[model samples]
Target: MLSVKKLEAFYGDFQALFGIDFEIGESETVSIIGSNGAGKSTFLKTVCGQLKAAPSAIIFAGEPIGGKPANEIVAKGIAMVPEGRRLFRSLTVEENLLMGGFAKRSGPWNLKRVYQLFPALEEKRNNLSTALSGGQQQMVAIGRALMANPKILICDEVSLGLAPIVVKGIYDALPKITSDGLAVIIVEQDIDTAMRVSDRVYCFMHGRVSLKGRSADLTKNQISDAYFGI
Candidate 1:
């Protein structure tokens, strides 16, 4: 459903992604794993149109969409659960989630569906988003992104600040998401979680995909090598 070909990205002249190429199939969950500077985050930024790319680089549902603005990307059915859970601190929980659906896709995702996804969010819907705990805030973030009913959901470091139990709780919702035929591309630093949750995995090193395969087939040594560029 989404394809990125020879994606080269940069911050001003400081290039970060060097000819990165990858694809995510419809309803599939793919993880991008790498060391700190391997460009995993940059890859997602490029795909989401936060970073400009050549016209032919990012193709979403068949059209060349690289370099388009983030708002335009959402209109085309892509939503990002960004790293650090970049929520609007000033907005209430429900308001944050409502912003997610602003793309207005005609689909099964809505405020009701999101509240159902994270039951804790229901009662606190009217509270200021910053009032929630880290995990609860994470759920709000995910729910907010889901409100878009996006065809593809890109999660960048979904487990940055929570406990293991909280992480498990969020991951437990993945099956339901895939069941809805929404493609998920997760950029994760946690190798164990990434391996456990993904259908396929790509390991980036020095800005290129050094390894890509079904998660079940990659070995510890292979992942270690690809992760650290060993």
Candidate 2:
């Protein structure tokens, strides 16, 4: 459903992504795994139109969307749950979730569905978002993105700061979230988690895809080599 062709991204004169190419199909979960400074986040930024990219670089549903504004990207059915969650601390849990509906995309995801996906969110709908625990806050972030009813959900470092049990709880909901054919792209530093949740995995090294293949087929040695640029 999405295609990237020879994508190169930069920060002024310093380029971050070097001719990176990737694809995500409908109902598929694709994970991007890499170490710090590996450009996994930059790849997502380019795909989501945060970084300026060549017009022909990113194609979504057969149309070139590279370099389009971020809002326009969300309107076109790509929503990002960025690193750090970035929830509105001032808003209540329900209000934060409501912000996602501003995209106005028609789909199966809605407030009710999101609550069902994370039942804990329902109990705290009226509480201040900042008052929630780290895991609960992460749930709110994901729920807020789902409110946009996006076709492709991009999650950057979803398990960044949470505990192991909490991470598992968050991941437990992924299957149901993707059950409705929503494509997902996950940028993760945890290789084991990425491989377990994704249908396919892309390992980035020095701003490029060093390895890409079926998640189950990649050996630990291969992933370790690619991750460390061996």
Candidate with top lDDT is: 2
List the candidate 2 regions with Cα displacement exceeding 4 Å: none
* Cα lDDT of model 2 by residue, 79-176, tens digit: 99989999999999999999999988999988889999999999999999999999999999999999999999999999999999999999888889
For candidate 1, lDDT tens digit of each residue in 1-230? 88889999999989998898899988899999998888999898888889999978989889999999999999889999999999999999999999988878888999888888889999999999999999999999899889898999999999997899999999999998888899999988899999999999999998899999999999999999888778
Residue 114 displacement in candidate 2 (angstroms): 0.6
TM-score of each: 0.98, 0.99
Superposed Cα deviation of residue 166, candidate 1 (Å): 0.4
Q: Backbone clash tally for model 1? A: 0
